[model samples]
Target: MNMRNLIVFSLLSLFMGLFLVLAFSLAGSGGVPQSMGVNNSFGEIKIKRMVAPDFSLDLYDDREIRLSELRGNVVVLDFWSSWCSPCRKEAAVLAEVYLEYRDKGVVFLGISIWDRDEDALAHIEEFDVQYPSGPDSKGEILVEYGVTGIPEKVFIDQRGNKVRKFTGPSTKDELVAILDDMLGSGY
Candidate 1:
């Protein structure tokens, strides 16, 4: 083959070999680990891309959710508090967006910070929240995500990279558009 063709073929083979190695490494480990690779300049890639902080929390409904387990889909991590007025105001909007994107492989998770389970559940029921929500009983998730106040919205792309963080309240249109931009663009 010509020199140009030989170079292209060699690069393709090298990439395929890398892919095989990555796949086997993941399978042998049972699940994806945190902080896969770091370049120290361009940031790191974990679980095939940028790493989102992983955690397992018990939901109000007795179900459990681990952020790392929700790979291969867009993960929305919103830090909210039931006592925050802005959070109360955006409750309906959040529920609407959550229901709208429920079927499109988008996972919306609400982490109620600085709130008691009793109050959070009451607020959740008052808003008729359909998606499962849980209280950050230990505040570890809040510290990990660097949440400062209620109504903080974080968007994680399909590869687990935190793509956007919206502090304070957001309108329904604003959130829906973001979801569309991220999910529709196939990222």
Candidate 2:
């Protein structure tokens, strides 16, 4: 081949090799492939890029509850342990918000992590939590959600998308504001 043709062929080969490397990297990362059609509901759901891992736990009442089952309503998943002081302080605020918004289709599920069921139940009783509370028994929820501390709150939109996350104690006003926004969206 002439020099010009050789140069052109080399450039084309280089471009093709780069494209294949990028494609392989993307495929190995397990990201949504561009070839596969994107789900339109993902955009409508509001939580982009972050997938909420599903889990099931036993409630204090001995009933099994699955996070995926509450997909039609906004959910607040509070991760707490009875030994956490900040969690103790935040329990009442959570309860208040639950009471105010439960009728409006908002659900709060308190999942205790790294604590005994009896102690968690005692704290719930002490804080007067009327909503369903449960034990994370195997720490699966903590690991799935990447929780490194106690009293982490995750807000899931009506479409089962995780829209927001908060670590530490949340005031009543903050909780109320979030609920207001979620309710305003007609969820």
Candidate 3:
């Protein structure tokens, strides 16, 4: 190869190697994949009961769950990762809420983005999470929902409307209040 051609080839190989390292690093970080287009800005809210985008995902327990199939029931989609500290805190609260309202016609599904299956599984077991959760292997749901960070939550009502959303970790009381209103627990 000519001197100029050799230099270009070497540079190209260096960039490719860097890209692979970054991809693999991110794949292990338990955060959302950067290619999925993050939108972590729920601070400037223009909330509405828009249709919750539908998706089908494979759960760790060998079950396939579909958002559209969950109509007529309240659905709470939690975007989280094992490596995130806040997500670890949220897991306990989520399990508490899930235990309380699961039988009351509410479904809580955890979507693990930018994560490996074993790490996600370890997180679930560590937190004693009783809810169904799994890896979003291709980040399809994250991109669809505009998720930009760990521990983000999207609440869908019985009619499949994306009625509300919460970014960051939420407390048990906060989640309970929302569920109570959605399910009309007292009425």
Top model by lDDT, which number? 3
The parts of candidate 2 lying over 4 Å away from their true place are 1-49
Query: Could you report the Cα RMSD, in angstroms, for every candidate shown?
Result: 17.8, 13.5, 4.4
What's the true lDDT of residue 115 in model 2? 70
Error of 2 at 158 (Å): 0.2
Model 1 misplaced regions, further than 4 Å: 1-49
Candidates in order have lDDT scores of 0.78, 0.78, 0.82
What is the C-alpha lDDT profile of model 3 across 107-155, one tens digit per residue?
9999998777888899989888888888899878888887777678888
Residue pairs with colliding backbones in model 1 are none
Name the lDDT of candidate 3: 0.82
Candidate 2 on 1-187: residue-level lDDT in tens?
A: 9999999999999999999978885684344233222111211122343557888889999899998898878899988777677787788889888998998889999888777677788998999999888987777788888776767888888888788877778898888888789878843
Can you give the TM-score per candidate against the true fold? 0.72, 0.72, 0.78
For model 3, what is the error of residue 79's alpha carbon versus the real structure, in angstroms, after optimal superposition? 0.6
The candidate that wins on TM-score is: 3
